[model samples]
Structures are given as structure tokens and as C-alpha cells.
Target: MNSVLIIDDDRSVRSLLRSILQKKGFKTRECADGTSGLEETVGYRPDIVLLDLLLPDMHGLEVLDKLQKAPVTRAIPVIVLTGSTDQENRLSALRSGAVDYIEKPFVAEEVTLRVTTQLRIHDLIKSLQTAVQGLEDDLKAAGTIQRALVPSEVPAGIEDEIRWIYLPSSSVGGDIFDIIPLNDHSYLVYVLDVSGHGVNAALISVMVHRFIEDFRSSRPGDREPFSLKEFMRSLDRNFQFERFETYMTATCVIADLQKGEIEVSNAGNPFPLLLERKYTQRLDRDNNGAIGFGMVKGSTSVHKISEETRLFLFTDGIVDVRTCEGTRLGEKTIADLAESTRHMELDDAFSKYQALLGESLPGAQTSFEDDVTFVAIQF
Candidate 1:
């Protein structure tokens, strides 16, 4: 049964309320003063509190304050009992955090009705909180599954250094990535970004991740030497963005360990950066729009590393970060940042880059502008 706590200094009032509440089938507790009432409130952890404004020891408002301060009793519903029906007393009680107000010399019907009303409200709030918590739990579980799909390290026997970062804009996000080792000499890495954030975008991102994961597991064209062009075309056809209103962009980079070459197929995303000892240059361009727009063959860009090379691949979130100086860190600025990192190892380089972006703008890391994701490969 739902519990009720009555706190009043008058013996007759407490007895009357207890009788009425017992007849209504509520479990009730009583205290005659504010100090004892507070102790009862904390001990009973009642669903609702009947708090009388006039008390002998401590002010009734002080009791309410104690209840609000304690974590255990703070959430209980409170109905303030007052001697006057004046607006001043009512406002004061409300401002002090009472859920409802009751005038003394109470009518039997009105008292029962008000108590039932507050109890109903309390039950409704608790139901909503439970539903919200369920949703949060589901999102956390889905996020864990998505992270598991994203490989933290490159697959075995792929002889190269690989590092990546994924910072979602919220508890769950729309950025997804993976590194699949094709053979001893070649491996595949991809970065994808949906146009928006939140549940719909996150769901779409999971779908995209699953599609790529299934394709990789099936060993796409292992025997026939799968073309990056064919792979992207397949993804485009499978997703068929014309049916859905949401748009997305993606880049798939194939890095060959033995040949020291990179091939890319992109859909309206940023170009990969080739970072060397002295300079940084963005690799080939794709004339096509985003993936859902029927982008076809030869949007591929090829780059062969001359000396020691570190390739930078990222979603627009990294570049789109707006700084405290009010400058939107765009593609050019990201390239410049990567260029400066040539002296550091790829892991240190990209981590420091993310750190700088966060420090450059207050609350940037904790409250992201978007889903910031990047993959760095050293060859």
C-alpha cells in the first residue's frame, strides 16, 4: 500500500488525519513536532508527507528544508497544512517546495480528494521516471554493441600502426568506424557520418555499421580482389537513400602495407590527409555528393607514399568544432593542425590534436559540437 506521513503538533488533528487515511487504505505514520516529523520522514521514506506549518520546536519550513536536503526523503511529495487560506501563505508554501496546500478545519471530502490527487501525481511521476530510465538503459546497451563492432586495434598480421578516436555528441551517436584486415599486405578502414544526432541518427548509423560488418565478414571479393569502387557501389545500392529522407556521407580507405599505397572512395566527405615530415596535403577529391545520391565509379583517389607517411581520416565533426575565439575550425585548419603534428608519433599526434581542440574551446570535450571521430594510420 502507498504510505503517508502526517506531521502536526496538534494531537486531535493527527488522530483525525490518521483515521481518515486508514479508512482510505493508506499506510500512515504520525509525528507531533517538526524535529520528530523530520526523523519519521527520513525513517519511513513515505510516498507523501502531510506537513503542518505551525510547530512548537523548529519552524515547519525548517522541517521541509531538512526533508529536501536529505537524498532519501527529498523526492517525497509534500502537502502543506496551513491555518489560513490567504494567498500569501499559499504562495509561501508553494515557494518552499510543497506540492499542494491544505487549509486546516478541513472538509472531509476535500481532504480525501486532495490526498488522492497528490498520491496520483506522485505515481504518475514515478512511472515516467521509470520509463525514461528504461530508455537510457537501452541506449547504453546499444552504444556498447556499436563500440564492440568498431575495432579498437587493426586485425592481426596487418603490419602498420593504427590509432583512432570516437567522441560521440551524446550518450549514443551517429559516428561509426572499423578496420578489417584483408591480407598480410592490405587492410580496410572506413569513417562514416550521418547528417544529424540523437536516436534516429544513431539507429541509422548502427544499420550502416552492421551492413559493413556483414560485408567484411563475408570476405568481399577475397578471391576476385574486391575493388573499392565496387564496395562503395554495393553500399550505395544496399542503403538506397532515395527512399529515406536522411542523408549520410562516408569514406573508405584501403591501405596496402607491402606496396605503401592508398586508395580511397568517398561520398561528399572530407579528403584524407597525407602527413609527412615537412608538409601535409589532402589526397584526391570526389565530385559526387553524399552516399545516398547515386555516386558511382572513378570517384577514387590514389596516393603512393614516398617516405614515412601518416594518413589522417576523419569525419567533419573534428573540423566543424567552433572555438571560443568564434572561429569554426574548418578543413583547412584541421590540415594545418595535422601538419604541425608531423614531429610526433601518430598516436601522440592525433590525441594531442583532439586535446587542443577541446582546450581551445571551453566545454568542447564534455559537450561536443558534434560526433568527433578520426582514424590515423602510420606507414
Candidate 2:
């Protein structure tokens, strides 16, 4: 039979509870004060404790605090029995780690039902913890594999200096950006963000990177410069065959500094920002396209690449971050900040923007409900 400890100052209440629990086939122990209850809890090691809020010697909450602190009594499920049904009292009881809260006048059947349910949930939680530990081990292995797939160092032939910042909200992130040098003077700069977070998203990102590498390698003949429109079409076709529900938002900017030309195409991503002469402009005006890699079946709207001195491609995580006042840090803010810091180095501009965000939204917490990635190139 399960043992239960009932603690209350009222004699009548304690008697009623002891009788009811005894009749229900539970071994019952009763105490009249909080101090005695705390001592008895440690010595008796009862399976469950029915604790009251009001007591003569010490407050019931204090008894609960002691039980929580004692490792032996901490796992003994506690159900707070209180006369008050105020929201604050209920929240306090719950926050103090009571398994459940029961009002003083709770029905006998309801109390028994709640206790049984809590025991069952406790068992379930233990099982789930074991399962999760196994899953965590698997995830660690997956993270290793994913990290290995990403290029350790920028390819040697890429003429442009590339600097990247990648942060995964989870063990792995879905955001991926790479600078693949096609030749000595020009390179393929692409930034992609998968729709979701975690292992699935990271796996999809790796697959996308492999596909991009394969596509570039398979192309025959002299490296002819293709328009941004052609690149987007190829991506759409590739996604059509994969048939995966996961969609990828990407911005691919092919920069040829020797020719002083940049071809950019974006599919449902934040517009790439450009800076020059203390001015910032959004390179792609038409943000009206669907994400590629199975988000949509057909070709999406494309924006013709325009010339710019410095180009930046980023994920929505940066712009959609909320300020301390709950306002979104939108594209306008980013553009303005970029323009203001145009004279600074590309790396300096990024650092300044980060500081500006932190300063502007003081006390705002990080992890803005999404992953953020920024890729900048100066030509």
C-alpha cells in the first residue's frame, strides 16, 4: 500500500484526511504543525505528502522549501492543500515545486484522482528522461557529422576576402553560407537558411550545400557567367525533384570584382543590403518569391542583379529580432545602421550593428525566436 503524510494545524481536517486515506487502502500519518511535518517527512520517507498552507509553528511554504532542499524528501511528491484559491497562491505553490495544489474543500474522489495522475506522470517523466539521454547522444554524433561537412577553410583560389558568422540556436543551425571560388578573380557567394531549427534543418542545409557544389562542378565548358535568373531557375528545378516539404530561402550573389559586376538573385529571403559613400540601398527590390527546394512547385519571381560596392546577404533572424519594447528590428533599421556605418570596415560595420541593437533594446533577451546569419563582401 502507498504511504501518505498529511500535515495541517486543524485537528478535524487531519482526522478526516487520515480516515479517508486509511479507508482508501493508503497508510496514513498525520502531523499538527509545519516543523513536525518537515521532520517526519525526512524520517518516514512517505511516498506522497499532503501539505497545508497555514500552520501554527511555521508557514507551510517554509515546510515545502525544506522538503525541496532535502534530497531525500525532494522526490516525494507534495500536493499543497490550501484554503485560498487565489491565483497568486496557486502560482506560488506551483513555483515552489509542489506537484499539485488542492483547495481546502476539494472532493475526496478528486484528490485521489489527482494523486494517482501525478504518480503516473512521474513514472512517465522518468522514462522520457532515459529516452532523451539516448537521443542526446545520437544528436552529438550528428553534430559531428554536420560540422565535418562544412568546409573548414575558405577555398584557396577565391580572390575576395570572406568572413562568416554562423550561430546555431540549437546544437546545429539551419543557416548556411559559403564562398566558393570559381576562379582567381570571381567567386560564387551563397547564403541559405533552412525553414526549421535543429538536426533536421541542419541535415537539410548540408544536403543543399552538397547540391550546390555538385551543380557547380558538373557545369561543362569555360566558366561562362550566367545571369541570376538562370541560377534561380536551376535551383527551382532541383527542388522540384527532391519532393521534400522543407523549403530553403537563399541569396546567391556572383561577384566579379575585376569586371566590377555583381549578379544577385534571392528567393523569399531578406534583401541583400549594399553600402557605398555613406549610403545604403537594398539591392533586390522584389522580395516577392517563394523559397526554393520544395517550398513551391514552380519558378519564382526574380530580381535582376544590380551593381554595388559592398553587398550583404542575411537571414530574417537579424531583422525580425524584437526590441525591449516588443517592436521588430526591421529592414529600415538595418539599412539606416549600415548607411551610418558605411565608412567603417565590413567587420567593423557588423560589430557596430550588433552593439547598436544591444544598446537600442536594452535588457532585450537574445534568441529572437529564429536563427540569424549575415554574409558581407567588399568588392
lDDT of each: 0.81, 0.74
What's the residue-level lDDT of 160 in candidate 1?
A: 78
Candidate 2: misplaced stretches above 4 Å? 1-64, 70-73, 78-118, 128-159, 167-174, 196-202, 219-231, 257-261, 278-281, 285-288, 291-308, 359-364
lDDT of 2 by residue, 1-379 (tens): 8888999988898888887777778898999999899989999988889998888998888899999998988888899987755667667888999999887776888777877778778778868988999999888787677667655667786645455555556667788877777666667788788888888788888888888877777753246654456666667667553576677788887776566666676777898886666466676665436565444333323222333366778888788877767788898888877787777776787787667555544454544467777776666
What lDDT score is found at residue 331 in candidate 2? 89
In terms of lDDT, the poorest run of 10 residues in model 2 is: 297-306
lDDT of the structure predicted as candidate 1: 0.81
User: Can you write out model 1's per-residue Cα lDDT over 1-379, one digit (the tens) per residue?
Assistant: 8789999999999999899888888899999999899888878788899998888998778888788888888789899888865667667778878899888888877778999998898889999999999999998887787677778667888767888878888877888888877766788888999878877788889899888767776775457564788778777777666656677788888887567788887776787788777677777566446777676553787778754888888888888888778787888877777877788877788788867666755752475768888888888
Query: After best superposition, candidate 1 residue 95: deviation in angstroms?
Result: 1.8
Per-candidate TM vs. native? 0.92, 0.63
TM-score of 2: 0.63
